[model samples]
Target: MDAQPSGRAMVSRGTDTFCATDGRPATHLPVFDGSLPIMTEQPMVIEDSYTGHVSPGSAPQRRTVPGATITKMSVGPMDNNVYLVVCSATGKSVLIDAANEADRVNQLIGEHAPSLDLIVTTHQHGDHWLALEDVAAATRVDTAAHPLDADALPVRPDRLLDDGDTVTVGEVTLDVIHLAGHTPGSVALALTEAGGGRTHLFTGDSLFPGGVGKTADADKFASLLTDVETKLFDRYGDDTVVYPGHGDDTTLGAERPHLGEWRERGW
Candidate 1:
């Protein structure tokens, strides 16, 4: 994706004109004077529903589950989705993909979570870790990633995650499921409710709304499809919500019927 230029405007006060950094036009603002009070930008109001569509520079959407609260934000030039999972009981949190825009990610952490315990990188793709080092250094939190892709990350992961391994935040536990294809160690994290309420799967780039993530060849595609079918689709129910690393969110129920189509198309 092409980078978006920062919005700027020229403000004229008295006989002098100066540049101002704001999306709003100078015509929209009242004339500035020494006697006038400064106007502060209002905070973006978060929406209630989880529509699965968020754009860069927009407010993050949030969803509250049985034991945790999940906040989704779209960041960077690639529009990578960054998720913040916070345990409702203890306020301890886990961040999934500090994808990009360190300043924006830090602002999100400061506003939404009480404490960030760990940051998990789903894969070693450059787009997925544009802000990982900065966020990790700022938060001073432990990091986790699959060993296969660990060496490629900017900051070495403190913990090497494997399939069946569980990551905990306060009282909530997320089960890791390795889905290889897009990368050597691409993984997905699943958080199942106590009963049979709903399961939320953070599939990273492995699974998206319409199909599996991109792969280099037929063999890789097959490997990803197989892992996704058995480890994800087969095990989880139709109601399972899928949160991908990019774009909008989806559910297994929504994409279940198209598994055959995706396989036949080989992508």
Candidate 2:
């Protein structure tokens, strides 16, 4: 798991390069014990198909996902993607990655907030959670995130979310995933909108179009890719769209064609 042990290029997905898979502590998912688990990184599955809607906003564009309305917000030094996940049926919403711009977060929440069910952070990084306090203060809702990243919040989470945990916004449910590459606490969310059987993954920093997250710790990097290959790729088809923390959104299929190359690059 430690950076593939010598960066030996593995022949995978028609590419030749050393992909980073550092076997960091965060990367290693815990073995399920009988008792209440200290940390969980299991991938969640959607139980039902529901419809969701994203209210039109200043962004001027609203896209629809399997069972939810997807509103994309441009935020952060990296222009980190912030998503307003709302369920159409019950009008419940979840805020993803409130990285700074407190005023904007407040404004959006005040104007279009729908029950503000949960505030989900991608990781503990400053850029991804700068405005977490403001958003939480304004909405007075519970927060959900990877076990490792929960400490980033000003207030501890009311409850902790594991990989398989399901978060509901209105009627829509998002499955939690711990990718844990960009940081020990890195996580992802997967959900399907109505009318479409396809799934979408919000891969915070574990994955990007043609690059993987870089890591100084080889162990951590290995854990990241292992989860990506097994938990993410095994469960989700190449067709699933990848909404990353920064940069343009891409699909698993789109990235698959370049997985080997990306791995070698040690992104």
Candidate 3:
């Protein structure tokens, strides 16, 4: 998918990465250590507002959603992909980036898995948090956001999260990581789902379908890119599906092609 400019300020995460920092393009997958804890409920709004539709994204060839599953759903805009991470056995669930469409998000989860228990935010953008109230209204779940971003909330988060912490819902466990570039308070979710069959990451604006988020810190952004390529890419590979802040779903494999160009051009 090609990138489009939304109306709001395009905040750059900076050039802290070695790969795909040019903003050319790369399908990104998050590499994570299952360490951060998840508190379960969360909320955001748009300052640099973007208005568009979310795409269905690449249909997963096969899903573990029904089996040892971690079900994810996209809501808001053109379905900005809100995720429902569920443990098939225990029926415990968490919501990620409900966006401005929490109603749709909850419907999907309530229909598919009934025991949802948490909500999370990847960053402080408006689209990510707007529908959070609706989601909370539907479910009596605890909400969570990074401690750095805890103040951005319209409502106090049930939990204030930081790096390397862990939160559990039934059997599903999620780890939180703070990559503060998108908003000085943005964070990402790294979780081991389905009894740790594999690891998954819900990177907010930190990384996108084909590129990392935009920020003012070019050097730091470049290093973040490097961390993705050398560290995250090397570990996660192209197979891992990286659920991003906006746009289509991507795999590290799809993103690998754009790395060199991003690094050289230096966005």
Candidate 4:
């Protein structure tokens, strides 16, 4: 894990290259040999964009799919990405990854707090749930995670999501896809619009834009990669929008063609 490049972008001089938040390949981005620089807070504002409404003056984040609106907020020292998945038709929503900063997360909920029905922790990694307990306590909403990772969380999850289980927000239901290796209980959520619209895949730390998530070793990497390819690429088409836990959002189409390249390089 230490081999993973820090989030900051710096001059390149190392073998360990890192991908930019956008979908660019690591070979095309900067490589750093030190820890990611200290993360600085920046003002984030919601503004309408072509893909969706993004937090302008900060990192470009947010995705508006057919039936839901997705928003991202980076928090904590680790720069964990938290997402808000809201159903546009019913306003019912779910908050994914309350990594840290309880007040900031609660504020993101804003007036829609009441419509929030679930607090989903993608996995039990401490960085992914530093503010889980506080946020869950404040929202008074049921928390959910895979049973394998539930025990690792600071707060007990009210709902245990299985591989094929589905959770509903108003009229929309999100299908759960269990993707392990990154963590024993890592999972991705998929949503399809009622009338055959675009599909959205929320991969916690399993899949990313340039490549798959960081694994402890080659075997773990292979397992994560295999799962992603079989369950995601092979199953979903190029149109599926991918909202990863960290960095920027990308689509399956932008990443599908590089599967062989990523596997051979063994990042």
Q: Which one is best on TM-score?
A: 1
Instruction: Please give, for residues 177-262, the per-residue lDDT of candidate 4 as tens digits.
Output: 99978988899999886687778888998998799988888898888899999989988879988878776678999999899999
Model 4: lowest-lDDT 10 consecutive positions: 1-10
Estimated TM-score for each candidate = 0.85, 0.74, 0.68, 0.78
| 46-124: candidate 2 lDDT, tens digit per residue | 2123222112122413466556776666654456667777787777898888766665665566555546788888877
lDDT, candidates in the order shown: 0.86, 0.67, 0.61, 0.76
TM-score quality measure for candidate 1:
0.85
lDDT of 3 by residue, 85-201 (tens): 667678777778767544445546555556777788776767677777666655667899887777766556898788777768776677776675566677777665453455667
What does the lDDT read for residue 9 in candidate 1?
Answer: 19
The better candidate by TM-score, 2 or 4, is 4
Worst 10 residues of 2 by lDDT: 1-10
Task: Give the CA lDDT, 0 to 100, for residue 212 in model 4.
Answer: 90
Model 1 lDDT tens row, 1-267: 223222211222233322245535545666777797775534446676878899888889999888888999998878899999999999999999988887678767766777889999999988888888888876778999999999988899999999999999999999999999999999899998756589999999999988999999999999999999999999999999999999988899999999999999996
Cα misplacement distance, residue 172 of candidate 1 (Å): 0.5
Q: What lDDT does candidate 2 reach at residue 43?
A: 26
